[model samples]
Structures are given as C-alpha cells and as structure tokens.
Target: MNDSVNRPADGAPISVVLAGGGTAGHVEPAMAVADALTALHPDVRITALGTARGLETRLVPERGYHLELITPVPLPRKPTGDLVRLPGRVRRAVRQTRHVFDDVAVDVVIGFGGYVALPAYLAARGGVRRRRVPVVIHEANATAGIANKVGARSAQRVLSAVPGSGLKDAEVIGVPVRAAITALDRAAQRAEARAAFGLPDDTPVLLVFGGSQGAASINRAVSAAAGELARSGVAVLHAYGAKNTLDLRTPEPGDPPYVAVPYLNRMDLAYAAADLAICRSGAMTVAEVSAVGLPAVYVPLPIGNGEQRLNALPVVNAGGGLLVDDADLTPRFVAEVADALLTDPPRLSAMTSAAAQVGHRDAAERVAAVALDIALSGRAARGRRR
Candidate 1:
C-alpha cells in the first residue's frame, strides 16, 4: 500500500471522493480523515458522496466540502417493498456515481461504510483498466456492517476500528476522530471547562449521553438516580435530548451540581470537564471517549445485530471501561456503579491509563496516509503502464 505516495511531484495533485453518512457515527470519521488529508497537504482536492436522506446533507457541507447526492440503498431486514426495488435503485445510484468520479477526476475513492458506500465502491471499479480506481474502506464498528463487508472485497486496503469486524485482512487503524479530541489536554482545560458548565473545579463528574437524539432508557435510569449520585459526591452532566421534557434538576440544597441541558453543543468541553462517562456504546462515542482517555460505562443499544455491545468489548476487556446491558440499567445499578468508580481515584487513574493504551489519537493521519499512498500508487502505476 505504501508504494509511491512517498511524495507528490509539484504539478500533480491528488483528488479524493469520500463516501459515508446515515448518522454522525459514519459521517464524522469521514470528515475527520478529510480534514487530516487537507492538513497534511493543503493542495489535495476532496469531495464527498452521500445520500439525500442522511445527516451528510448538513454535516458534510458544514465541514466545508462538496457532497454529491446519491440514492440510499439500505438493505432490508426482511422481505419487504423496498427490497424489491433495491436492484433498480442501486443500478441508477451506481450510474450517477460513475458520473461523479468522471466529474471529479477522482484519484482514489475512500469510504466509511454506510448505505451510500456500496454505490461509491461499485463506481470506482468501473469494469475497465482505464476507469478502475483504488479503493480504501474504514469500518467503524466492531461487527462490520453489510456495506463495508461488500466494499472490503474490492478495496485495496481495508481498515477496522476494532477487532472482529469481519473484514478480511483488515488492518486495525482505529477510528478517525476530530482534532479537538486528538489534541485535547483535559487537565489544562479542566478549570475553564468545568466552570462553563457550572461545575466546581475540584470534583468528580459523570457525563451521561445517548448520542444526538438522546437515549430514553439511559436518561430515565440515570435521572432517577440523580439524587443518589449527588449524595455520593459526584457532579452530573446530563445531555437530555432536545425534545425531552424530563427534568432531573437538583432537588436538595448544597448537592454537587447536576447540570441537565437539552443538548451538548460543545462535546470537547464536556469531555474536558468530566472524570468519567456513562453513555450508549456507539462506535464514534467509544472512539472519542477512549481517545480522550476517559473511562466509561457503555450501555449498548438493544437493537440491530448486537454490534454496539461488540464495540465496547475490546476496551472493557482491556480494563479501560465497563459494559452494562440496557435491560440492567436501573437507577440503583447506575448509581452504585458510578459512585464506586467516582469515589475511587486509584481505579479511575488506572482506567484512564488503560484507555490511553487502547486509544488511537493519530488514526486520522494514519488512515489519510493509506488513502494518499493508494492514490499516488495508482497514478504511478498508470503512468508506468502508459
């Protein structure tokens, strides 16, 4: 994979087309790698491919990149109406994507697997030597998604965030996380970050969240134990979903702050302010938390193919965190677990070090390096052939 991206000549420029996004989990990593590539070589041209319906329509552009639209081809779980239309819809999407590759003159196609990735993968393998392009895939989950499984077959390099992702010959490159997280110095920023959240400077905090929409099960269970956690001498930063009306406001006077807000606009600040975290185990969340060296209690969402549970297993096994079943997340259980960890500084310190050992803060640069090498190698290969 490292054949000739040794460096690019003056006049030659590398262009990339990145594909992913149905949720922040898929979109954010793609954006992070794009950012890393631009940082490494400002002249590198980058474009993105996403479905009209995914979060990419908002996030990709907000991150300052052009996003070409494609039809979403979500694999149906069972025999359904959409399943029948899958073949025709996918064919049209691939046709449209081929035009995008031509329009961009894409040197390499990189994908963080999602509903839109299969089309991008198909377009890159244009059925001819002249049109064929090198492909790289990044799998964000411990258990691979269907799109990634297919993309891996033809990808020049396949990268996985955790082990057991089911991508053949996959290299574990960790997840590409934002620079703010990668460069975070929690100790230096702790005073300011805690103050901004109305928390005391010298105290333990438990940051609880359930991704963008918030987790009702997590919220309900945690909120119920708010008093217990406070009595145990820990501050709480609860990001209730924007639509939630439930209040876990501090009841008794002189209790450590239990700051409950609808959403956390600045996640970096939240991470800087917290000592430990209790959140749903999504791939991105696990990556970010571990990247920051914060220990966590991961409650995997009880849906899908049990991938969420799989995502946290590696860290948990490494002594970096704990895993709790969604069904077992009662108020009593949450309070006892959080209190035990918060009150024990030795355990907290050890876990932080363990998480640091497992986390990959420079993964963005590493994955970007692979993508650039593949692109440069393809260009050199073509030139030699000519």
Candidate 2:
C-alpha cells in the first residue's frame, strides 16, 4: 500500500492549510509540522490560520510563513450572557474560514486544537456547505481539549501525542518537537552544551522551567529550596516568566548555583545540559523532556480543567518521571526529590532510559507525511472529476 502518495507528476507544489493558535503549546507543534513538510516537500506551500489574540501574529511571521487571522470566542460552559454571544462569533469565524479556503484553494486542513481550529474543521466537514476538504486533527494532551473534541468528528484521521485517549480512529504519533531538540547528539553535545551555558561539567544539572510564561507556584517552590538544593550539589537553571521574575527573590551568595533567566531562547542546550528537570507538565514540555531522555519531577499546574495533569500521566505511569501536585509542592518536598534523583546514579539512569523509550523522535516527519498524503489525494480526486 502507498502509505503516502507520491508528489504530482507536474511538479506543482502541494498546498496546506494549518489552523490552531493561542498559546505556544498549540502554535509550536503546528510550526514544527510545517517545517517538516517544507523539508520533505520543498514545493509545499503552507498557510497558517490563527486568531489575532494568539502568539501566531509574531511567531508565524518570524518563521517566514503567511498567516490569516480570524475572530474566536472561548466555549462557555453554562447558560450565561457569554453563551448568547458565542453563536455569532462561531458563525463569523466559520465565514472567515470559508473565505480563506476559496482564496487559497486549500487542499487539506490540519488543526492543532484551539478555538481557531473549530472554524476550519466546520468548513472541512461541509458544515458551511462548501466543497469538501480533508481534515486532520492532532491532540497533544492525554485529555482532549475542547477544540480537538469538536474537530475529531470531521477529521478523517486523528493523531495523538499520547495513547489510549479513547478517541476512535486515532494514531499515537507522539508530540512534534523542534528540529534542534530532536537532532542533538546527547553524548557528544552534553559537554559542549554545559560549557556554552558556563556550567561546570561535573555538577549535576537540574533544569527548571514552567512553560514560556512560567508558573508562579513552581517559581516560588524552587526559590524557597534554592539554598538546600545547592548544598546537595545540584546546579539549577531556572526560566522564570518575565511577569513572575519580579516576584522571585534574588538568590543570595552561596545558594544553589543557579542561572535564572526570564525565558530560555535556547531550549536544546538547556535539555542537553540537564541531568534532571523540575517543571510543569505541559504536553510540549513532557515531549521535549522525553525526546532527550531527561528525567523530570513533574508538578502539573493545578488549574484549568486538569489538562496539565493529564499531559503528565503517561510519563509518570511509564516510570519516566515522578508526579507531584502543585498544592503539595513545597520547598522541602522539591529539595528532597531533587536530591534523591540527583544523588542516585542508577535510578536517574533508569528514568532517563524510560523517558527515551516513550519519545517518538519521528513525530514531526510522520504528521507531515499524513498532511502531504491528504493533499495529494485531494488533487488526484479533483483530476479524476475533470
């Protein structure tokens, strides 16, 4: 069977429509897949659709891709004043998507899951009564997000980052990580990464980050235990969100040797140098940590429908990491865990092995192949009609 259809004989580029954006969680994976598609098929044209409220306005352009903006409203739970306004917003977004499809002559729509994805899915499924377009949805979290839940119905194939999400017709493709992270040569790169970061080669490195925006609970917990962790011979690299940086106290002299930054622009190096990680369990973070086989002590964000906890479940269950609740995250607790993991060489090695076992290094390539296949299939079907 031809799993991925070959490129058109005319050498014309296949076109793709990508929908989903709001946070880096959604945008980053979409961009990764786009990059992979570009590499695989140099002639592929990628057009991204996102909302003005998302990071895509800056991110998409920075990556040298075209972006179309649409209006999106969050889904409401109860019959409130917001519910009355939702239909109008949804209708507007759907109309905008219809216009985009016509303008771009889109072949296939790939959704990464956000309010922006809803409209694309609706249009692809003929909800707007337009020409049918193939739809694909990728759910990165173990617990499906609202947008993915809606998009799944219209999706021909649903790809998940974690397995056993109970969604029918789903493939466990793992999460797409940036190319840099996936390409790193762990053994050869480790020492160089440590030297570039000005960290001692012999010190046990502990990478701490709470997503791009940073987590307040994690910041506080790490700060409180900085001294204790330092005494236990662990070097900490903390990426505190810009907004939360002011709230953290400057570590005094002789404390855990930490290099604190507002954000880490070079994540590959951070992962390369870390022997262990303490972080919130965002889907992307979990995937990155697992990709590099960096063992972690995960403290899932205790808010917003338990999505973070769900993201970490598979790793924890697989013995790739430890799960700690945010409410239970204390200075003493973090220090104890960090010390235990850092000091025990055999246990740390085992966790690292497990993490590597669960990582899908080819996720981006696989997802890109699926998108290209759908686009090629659509083109073939159109030719037959003629």
Among the numbered candidates, top lDDT falls to 1
Q: Which residue pairs does candidate 2 place in steric collision?
A: 230-256
Regions of model 2 farther than 4 Å from truth:
1-6, 127-129, 246-256
Looking at model 1, report the run of 10 residues with the lowest lDDT sum: 1-10
In model 1, what lDDT does residue 124 have? 84
State the lDDT of candidate 2 residue by residue for 31-127, as single tens digits: 9999998888877889999988899999999988899998876787778998999989989998898888888888899998886888888877764
Q: Write the per-residue lDDT of candidate 1 for residues 1-386, one digit (tens) a residue.
A: 34345466435778899988688999999999999999877778899988888999999989999899988888787999999999998999898889889888899988998888989998888886548888999999998888889889999999999877899999998999999899998889999899899999877899999998899999999999988988998889999899775656547888998898989988999999999999998999999999899999999999988999988888899999999999999999989999899989999999998987888998889889988987887787777888
- Worst-scoring 10-residue span by lDDT in model 2: 1-10
How far off is model 2, as Cα RMSD? Answer: 2.1
TM-score of every candidate: 0.96, 0.94
CA lDDT, every model vs. true structure: 0.89, 0.85
RMSD to the hidden true structure, all candidates: 1.8, 2.1
